[model samples]
Target: MFHFRRSTAVACLALAPLVAQAQINVDSISQDALVSTPESVDCTLTDGSTATCLEITVKYVPENLEVGPFCPAMIDDIGGIWDWDGDEAGLYRIDAAFLTMLDEMGYHFYDEDGTVHVFDIRVEGPTDDNECISGSFDEAVEMTMLIPTTPVMADAPVSLGTVAKVGVSLSGVPVFADAPSALDTGHMPALDVCAGHVDPGGWYHYHGTATDLDTVYDHAGVEGSCANAIQDAKVQFGYAFDGFAIMGSLEHDGSVPRDLDECGGHVDGDTYHYHASEEFPNLPTCLVGLQAEDNYSTNAAGGIGAEGKGPGGQGGRPDFAAMAEALGVDEQLLARTLEEAGGPQADLAAVAAVLGVDEDALRAALPQRP
Candidate 1:
């Protein structure tokens, strides 16, 4: 009896070469940056400043990949992948785990299908407002994604085989207190802590708030400089909200009845919930350590070592590099370059030169700054 398990998309890729006639084909890839045009939002800062917050955007279109059954096991009986991974029969489990992990690393996932399966993550300075035209059916799918602020190095003579893995880290701290002197450039554009995660390799990432969910104090805090070492890498992130929501006054005040109840307290129209790895013990291993923060429920990137407690356990976050391998993305070159760059924002020009794309184009591809 063939007791079949839902084969993860990553596992299929590893076995593809050995099998005949593979179905998934990542046809054409095109990208653009939304950095110059920031998403201005009214948000109050940790230091008590109410300013129009800026967000970046990045958009891309992937040509062909048999759209049917990308991950069949996780889909719901209704044939949609948005069944909240099948949690709480009533609520739509937004890929909270995936989104949280990405957000922890400064990335946001856009619900392309109006359901929760995220096609792409937003980086610092990146948002999602683009459409993807399917090459197979020429059907344009309207979707949203998180943007990045910097550029990536995928063009030119770069060796696809050289990339061994993509490393991403995310964190959220009071904008004023957590931001280091390295990221203290005056202009908010330059000072946007999100851009600090961009590298010459052009992969923009982040470790802050989301467009919808805001980081609150009751949750765990971000620790150390885990992001201080990877470069040209992508960071997952989202927008930060002050009180009950960004629109509310009394910044950081949990006084509001709903605010004290944590997000998704009563499940209003905008309420979103996701399962954490701890909650769904039956989830695929491939999906387990994929990202630090998955979305609304969990935090990612090596759990912060409680304030004043020095770096905790092993100093790294979830093993996304391993996940990248499962995704069939080049990891070797990715690893070496990041190891040498030290941090995402360091020496971006040189990194871009090495990757071979024009600096402008590279930055545009980044999800954060788009």
Candidate 2:
């Protein structure tokens, strides 16, 4: 369902030969990072073919690492970091100056005397105003993912666009495509120093490949670092859904590779794989191959997580049924409208257009902003 051309964010390269590949040893991942034993399961490939896959389940947060400090309580308080797309743009620390700049840009994440505005997108769904998006941690959340034992190059590169599911890092944290832009959505998902943030479902995930943040930070001139030791760019940080290794910005020889294709992928001898960019949100924006259908899901206690949400878009929230009823709109109609507009971060303008309601009224009907 996700096969297509991503807006030319990451350069796409010409196709490489689909060479024979071997299965990654599931044991290479730490046992603590996993919630259950890895199992070989029959799965449907993206090309409507069946293939064997390794199913791995992990906790919402990584085993022992500290997470957050996202969304500052006050402008002066040190929070996390954000890739500012406004004037004076670049990756920056979420400090007083950042909040001040946001306020100037019509994003009022702070008030007089400097208390910063923040809300749990998990409980409150999305807000209509420009504010910092944050959420509480839910210990019950767990994710199960499938990695095709061997990848098959797709008809076209699968775009890992939006906050789409990218892959899981070595630390067990889920990696995601670049965040939904604050410039585009009026919501700033403040990422920690390692370029990660909590999802609306209360699970922590990366907007960038935080495992290699040191390299990305150096390239973007952001003063941030990751907890893991900097690995060689050639070392595979993790595996994409297509079952190919994901590496950093350089080749095994410590030089920038010259053969990267549109998906930032190229053949390095027998292995055809993808590379992460050195820029902000240092991730491969597309996959060179197909991924399995129903590739991942979130679950807690005994119930499933979000129904249709991806790895980055999990922890189902109570829908807008009540809100729709309050506004005298059909519940299913409102739900479908928001889903198409990007639920949890659905653009209100689009919702108003679809529902034939005034944008201001829809905003007023949403859970009042903090």
Candidate 3:
């Protein structure tokens, strides 16, 4: 069954806004350093959605290009690196036994082919429609995702299916739905200790909250680096496809909000928004507002385009030299990094270190993951 941490009366009062305001300022989005080249579009929402709506396009790298000291360690024989903490406390390295168990459980990973994918993500809305949009979480959108074993309660609760692109993070990485795709056979595809991982197309994305490791405690009983990596208040991490802001577990006053709906959302007077949790399925269990189409797309560099063609076209490898040039790294270094880290299954932190560069630099130099 799905589980949620309900807030007490005191906590709710602490999180309530001190003053009610007009609609959320979509223009304020430009203030976020992670968002760039914001352009507006007028959209007519059909299917009984809403009337007043706006769409915007922004350019960003797929990974958290801001904070780091990424150290994705290579797992021997396991196609990809181990970067995520399965237990929420520390990192878990997927070994042969773990892989075997996951495989038995019906989860799989695929071999990498030494290519990176990137894209210009489009976001829209904040349309005054308060009506919640309903859809099955099991429906596959981008990639064929595995159904998560975890139970969820919503307007239409269903097994967790893979979502290629869910939302965008404040650090500029794409937040994928909270399950691994069936196409992956590595230990954990696109999931790392920081709650993010690289996709097969060579783009890094998040599957959960970006700050999950912030509250992590090690053997010494001290706060982890993730805690110190808070560049801004966790109030607003990113935006969902529907155009509503995705906040963290805490409120502006540092307290959890009560009365979250089944979709992990609640209304504060006029403003409606979603919240990230501290537990499994760290993001909203489902979208409470209407979502727009064509919010996400891949570039011809390595992503699947309108014609359903990716990288080298139909099921082909990407151009290594072109990818290296786009990433601004030496072709030889890029090739060696892929070879050592296992082709497209390369670990950013491990590969970056091997090439004598920082993770941020390497990520900045790379193309966007599709």
Candidate 4:
């Protein structure tokens, strides 16, 4: 597999002068992606300033878009894909050999009869131990996203972390930072050929810019590719939380941009925008502007919040405020610890030790999931 290396010629990320960004015209959104027509409304920025934003509610997948074959039936059969960071550390096909390799290292993904453990965690709920989870689709739930009509550049750029919430694609699907780590959660949410999966909330999202995955696939020697990615290298892929446009991996000339900043951003004419890389987690590395408060949300139980920054967890997730109060710890501290521990289903014993509490007590303090 080809290893990724940054060209030193690429400009390091630095604050650039803010250029006026155009408002997202509803026409740009694919008709199939929307559950309802977008609405422009007043909103608050993260900086406590007032701004207008476009409220967009999306459907599960784009019109006629098909994906999957995740979670193989047998150990030897190839199922989906994972951007593995350990044991070889490259894109891998989820076959029996891959599971066996992990199982040998004690991350059992199969039974003695070689039957791979598969679950629709969204329906069955999260587990205490590792299992391969592929979410089921839900049409009843709708996620509403708010992006400032005009982005406000931040005083300083911020790193995009796990599930970084990059922005929405042309198809109206959400584009995220990184998928939950199999290494961290013990559970694996296998991505289909295009490096996308159903979130536990039942919405479809991309962890990487599905466009131009071929570059990464070829580099990593991976066999499959994205199903609905824009093949036009120069075309815009999506928008970032900050409202900057995200381009496909290549320039209009079908050449890689050499001067991208740390956030994958560079000046494009009058506006500053980001570009996708031909690598895993191909979205922007950081946010260059201030986005709307409560930028993402859903009516679904596992949904993010309405006011801002949501619950940031799946359904049956423990309430942060209640758990923190019960644990007698700082809320911010507890939140950061759990995020660091790999999201909501973080290791309880490990978290207990960090908080200096008994594991059983911590578990009891957490809301019991059905």
Give the Cα lDDT of each candidate: 0.22, 0.72, 0.42, 0.73
| TM-score for all models, in order of appearance | 0.18, 0.81, 0.50, 0.87
Ranking by TM-score: 4, 2, 3, 1
Error of 3 at 52 (Å): 5.6
Candidate 1, residue 243: how far the Cα is off, in Å: 22
Give the top-scoring candidate (lDDT): 4
Residue-wise lDDT of candidate 1 within 32-120, one digit each (tens)?
32213334444443234343332322321123211121111221212111112112221112233433433344332334343323121
The candidate that achieves the highest TM-score relative to the unseen native structure: 4
**Angstrom error at residue 128, model 1:** 39
Native-to-model Cα distance after best TM-score fit, residue 258 in candidate 4, in Å: 2.6
How do the candidates rank by lDDT, highest first? Answer: 4, 2, 3, 1
Cα deviation at 232, candidate 4, in Å, is 3.6
Q: Higher lDDT: candidate 1 or 4? A: 4
Q: State residue 36's C-alpha deviation in candidate 3, in Å.
A: 5.9
Candidate 2: lDDT over CA atoms? 0.72
Clashes found in each candidate (C-alpha, N, C closer than 3 A): 83, 5, 20, 3
Better of 1 and 3 by lDDT: 3
Q: Which is superior by TM-score, 2 or 3?
A: 2
Model 4 reaches what TM-score against the true structure? 0.87
- Which candidate model has the greater lDDT, 2 or 4? 4
